[model samples]
Target: MLKALRCNSLERCFQRVTSLAEARQALAEPQTILWLDLFNPSQEELQDVGAAFHLHPLAVEDASHKHQRPKIEEYDSFYLLVFYTVQAEPSPERLRVCELSIFLGERYLITVHSEPIPELEETEQRWTRNVRQLEGGVIVLLYSLLDTIVDQYFPVLDAMVEQAEALEDRLFSGELRQRSFTQDLLALKKRFLTLRRIAGPERDVLNVLTNRDNPLFNEHALLYFRDVYDHIMRVADTVDLYRDQLSSTMDANLSIVSNDLNKTMRTLTAASIVLVVDALLAGIWGMNFEYMPELHWTYGYALALTVMAVISLLLLLIFRRLR
Candidate 1:
């Protein structure tokens, strides 16, 4: 899908351009700010756009591929930026990451992504409501897009924090078993690591945009990028803290499981000792020998039974006291 937003002197227009030819025509207009957004464009479409804008072949290739790390690369005529948009799945244990590639030029901006980003749609809505805000040229639009993407990280981080807290509560209350809770903690740990992998590099990307000298961004526009840099730093710090907390939680869970197992083994050992005493007495009495005089006595059977019962009771009392 291809969507375009054009802002001219008279009015602002937003439409979906169906063919590559239409997108090229929109870009041809003079003194207009055009935003072309392509969702999962084919190689042919990418090459056509690259040819039209004189974009470097290497940058076009990078845009066509996935799994690119977040960074900013400066070219002779434009800047190629890669950023990740994050979303938490219905299951809090997992996170979904989507790569958004942006080409920022003096008069035009192009965004390419395989997955749908709600942040882009929201930014378009904001642009429609007030076109004047984006009149500052492509830099303003670039800032708006980056700001929206950075803001999205907070809600995902918040959800993960809530999940960690809930798991901690269950751990202490003994509502979750060791095996089940350990699996959950492991899942949370993995998600946190994934988040850090994205956020850490992206923060550095923003830091470069803020500190480095780039002709694409003016003094006023650099300020906005710095603000975004601060937000990314906060997100990075929070992720680090959560990782430490998760490690501690896992260690505590393992300790609890070990302690429970030890108690069970102790109880089983005490029970086995009591049974062994009874078995020993039975073995002695059952031995058949003609020289055994007690076998002929009248009260011999009752006396033997009484003796066994007394010994068993005494052993039971001793075991209980030791426990």
Candidate 2:
């Protein structure tokens, strides 16, 4: 989808442009310094856009396909920047990531995405809901959009920390075994690692802009991006802490399982000892000794059975005391 936002002269109005002619028309307008967009152009659309703007072939390819890492390339005429954005569906509990390729021209900015981002809707709402006009300049809009996406990381990381802390409490409570809670912790650990893998590199990407000798920001809007970068750092640190907490949680679980197994082995060993005593008495009675005078006595059977019962009871009492 192609979206154009014009904030140059008076009120802010958004336009949807599908064709190259319309895009070029928006780019040609002196007032149209900002363009927020998503493009999944086909073969024809790609060529048309490339020819219209004199876009480099590599930039177009990078925009079309997914890239392994975030990057920024300074073309002779324009700047090609590849950025990553994450979408967390807090309701459905799903996470989706995509790359955003931005073309920053002298007067206009173009953004391309492999998939749609709800940040577009959010940006619109921020503009429409407020009575105050957006301040600074075109850079404000650009920086605000980036800032919005980056700022979302805080709540996500914070939520993960809360969950980790809760599980840590449950881990020692001796109640985690009843609720499939251990499995839940493992799943959370996986998600934490996933979050870290994305956040770390993306933080580094933003850090470049923060440390840039001549940043890609206007003097007034620079502070906002710097603040956004700081939030990114907070997220990285939180994820790392969560990762460590998870390792400890796993170790605690293993210790509990081992303790349970030891209890089971002790019970089995006590039963085996009783069985050995009974087997010895039975073997002596079955022996074919011809001079066994007690075998002829009618009370012999009763006496032997009574002796076995007493011995078994005595062993049981001893085992109970040992336990």
Candidate 3:
């Protein structure tokens, strides 16, 4: 879907532009700014918007493709930025990330995404609430979008922290008998890895937006971008920290499992030893000897049984003390 919001100094409020023709006309208005948003657009829609805006082929291609790295590229008349919006999926093991491609021109900003980004919606509402400050230029609007995206990471990180804590608790509580425990732990690690991959480059992207000599970004906008850069840095650091913690947690869990297995083996060995002693006594008594003392004397059979029971009890006590 395609949507457009047009803002101008004279208008004092955002005006809806319904069609590409209207957007093009609005672009000609003095001191005007335009935002075009496309969500889950088809190939034809992308081509139409790309052609209408005379967007660079590479930028348009990047928008069509999924899994583009987070970065910003300077085109002739605009900048193409690729970033991701992340949310934890219903399954705690997986992260849901949506790639958003933005074309930031002097007077317009066009955003394309295959999936819905709640940040964009929230940014729009924010702009509506603070139009006096954000509506002055597209740069400010872009700042708001970036700010929203960066802020969204914290909640996901918080959820991951809670999940990691829960897993750690479960690990210590002897729930390792569950078959899926290790798999879940590994999945959480993967999610953190993915978060790092996304946030690290995003920090660089923000760095470029703040430090690059781009005419589109004014001093005020650069400051806002710097603030966002700082936020992304924190996110990257958090990812790294959690990844290490999870690794340690996994190692501890492995050690616990090994210790438990060793205890089981020791128990089995003790049982085997007691049974072997009883078998040895029975074997000696069962020997075929016509002159054997146990066969000749009536009390000999009772004495052999008593000896076996006493040896077995001694072995059991020794093993119990050793354990």
Candidate 4:
């Protein structure tokens, strides 16, 4: 699906461009800036967008595929930027990553994504709310959009930390079994690693946008992008810190599981020893080929029963004290 919004400097308001022809018409206006968003575009739709905007074939191809790394590249007419949006999944996978490709031009901005991003809607809302104050350029819009995407990392990180802390608590609570405990830790660890992989490179993308000398960004826009850069840096740091925490959590869980297994083995060994004593006594008296003297005695049966009970009780006490 394709949606277009045009912001005109003279009108100081946002207008929706319903069709490609309308978008082209809006692009021709000197004081107007257009934002074209494509959600899961089909092959024909991509062709249309590429032809309409005169985008490079390589840029369109990159947008057509998924799993592009986060980076910025300069094309003939515009800049092709690949960025990742992440959310926490409820399944064992734990992390869901989506790629968003942005085409930034002087007069227009185009965004392509295979998955829906709430940040896009948030950026639109922010733009709508502050349309009158904005100077009707793509730079401010890009800043707002990038800032929203970077800010979203905070909540995702918070959720991951909360889950890690919960697992840590359960590790010592002695309530969780072995299998489920390990799976949860490993899943959480993977979540942190995913966040690190995306956020680290995204920080570099923002860094280039901020520090590089680009005529597209004015002083105000540079300030805005720098703010975004700062946010992504913090996100990168948080990801690294939590990744280390997850490693430690995994190690601690393994140690706890091993200790529990050893304790179980010790208990089983003690129980088996106690059972072996009774088996030994029964074996010696069960021979019937030659008559056993104790078996023929009057009180022999009671004496054997008494001896078994005494020995079992003594072994039980010893094992309990040792434990």
Candidate 5:
């Protein structure tokens, strides 16, 4: 389906079921400034649309596949933007990710995705309910979409921050090691790495502002793009910080466990030595039961007990000194 939303009016302004003929006609719009979305199209349909827009064959191929890394490609006439969306992880899972590809040109923007993401609907709703409240230009509208994606990055970061603090606390307090928590931290780090791969390419797409010759954003829109750039910067910084925190937390967890294990081993070593000495004494007495010298002594039992107690006390003191 092809849906066109006029930025100025902020309504589902003109949604046409675009056929090959209609798409060819759409290119002829004289003064329409609109956002067009095409979702879950078949391969033939993608090819038809691609042919209509003269898209890079490679870009169309990537769009048809299920797993294209998030990226941005600047073609002669428009920009091809590959981005991701998050869906609630089903049943027991925590989250699911989907990709979105956008073709942005001077007069209209085209979005393509395999799934109908709620974020797009939400974007549309915002455009519809609060149309006039928005800044009207294409870059501003683009910013809104980028802004939504970037903003979603925050909650992910925030959740990781909370997990980091929790892990830090557990490490300090010498609690049982949390292998799963470390795994979660690592998983989050990996996910953020994927995000980096996607967002990094976008820097090239949005880098238009720094160079005034680019047509994406005008002088008046540079600051808005700059603001979005700052947001992207913060997210990049946060990804790095969280990765560092995860590594540190894992190290701390390992250190705490090793310390606990070493302490346990030391105590067990002291006990083992003491047990050996006691066993030797008992064995000697037991074997020479035919009137052994120490066994025949009147106070032998008491003396043996006293000797064992002193040895135990001295061993404990030596261990304490070493510690």
Candidate 6:
């Protein structure tokens, strides 16, 4: 679906266009700033928009294709930026990343994404309610979009932090089964890695927009971009910290499991020794000798049993002392 919002220079007029053709018509107003958003557009639709705007074919291709890394590229007429929108799924083991491509020009901004972005909807509503917000021009629009995308990282990070804490509690409390804990830890690690992959480069992208000289962004707009960049840095740092925590947690879990196994083995070994001693005495007595002297004694059977019991008790006490 294609959605368009246009505001005039005075910020007094605002309109929403439903089709790409109507958006193109709105763009004809030189003093108007337009934001065109494409949600899961078909290849042909993307190509048509590209052709209409005279966008670089490479940029169009990147937008059409999925899984482009977060980046910013400068073209003669516009700037192309790719970013990932991240959200943690209901399951702690899962994460969702959606790619968003932006083409920012002097008077217009276009965004393309394969998934519905709640931030985009919020931004659209803000502009719809008050057109004056768009008076800062396309740069302000770009900043809003970036800020929204960066803001989303916090919730995902928060979810990860909660999961990490829960896992730690379970690990120390001995509530988590070893096998399941390992699986969960590994899964959380993967989620953190995925978040890092998205946030790390996206931070660099924002840095370029903020620190580097880009004709598309004026000095006033650069400050806003810097704010977004700072947020991204925070997210990146949190991801790194979480990764370290996960590693440490995994190590602690392994140590606990190893200690438990050692205790189990020790108990088994002690039991085996006692059983072996009992079996040795039984084996000797079972060897029936025709002239055994003890066999003739009236108390011989009682004496043999008492001796076996005493030996077993002594061995158990010795093992316990050693332990």
What overall lDDT goes with each candidate model? 0.85, 0.71, 0.88, 0.86, 0.68, 0.86
- C-alpha TM-scores of all predictions: 0.88, 0.83, 0.92, 0.87, 0.81, 0.93
- For candidate 4, the per-residue lDDT at 312 reads 90
Q: After TM-score superposition, what is the CA distance of residue 187 in candidate 1 from its true location, in Å? A: 2.4
Please give the lDDT score at residue 301 for candidate 3.
Answer: 78
> Once superposed on the true structure, which residue ranges of model 3 sit more than 4 Å away at CA?
134-136, 173-177, 289-293
Tens-place lDDT per residue, model 5, 1-323, is: 66656543333254544355665565576544567677788888788778877788888887888777666667788777777765334432144677888777776667888777777876766555654534444565666677677667667656656756766776678556767766765666666666566556555555654454666666776776777777777767776787787777777777777988999999899889878877776677668466557667888888887887888788778878887
Which one is best on lDDT? 3
Candidate 6, pairs of clashing residues: none
Model 4 misplaced stretches (Cα beyond 4 Å):
88-96, 131-133, 291-295
> Residues 208-280, candidate 3, lDDT per residue (tens digit)?
8888876677787777888999999999998998899899989998888889999999999999999999999
In model 6, the Cα lDDT at residue 116 comes to 80
Q: Which residue segments of model 6 deviate by more than 4 Å?
A: 128-133, 174-178, 288-295
- Tens digit of lDDT per residue, candidate 6, span 36-101? 999999999999999888899999999999989899998989999999888777776788788999
Ranked by lDDT, top first: 3, 4, 6, 1, 2, 5
lDDT of 2 at 169: 88
> Across residues 209-228, which tens digit of lDDT does each residue of candidate 4 receive?
98877788877788888899
Estimate the overall C-alpha local distance difference test score of candidate 1: 0.85
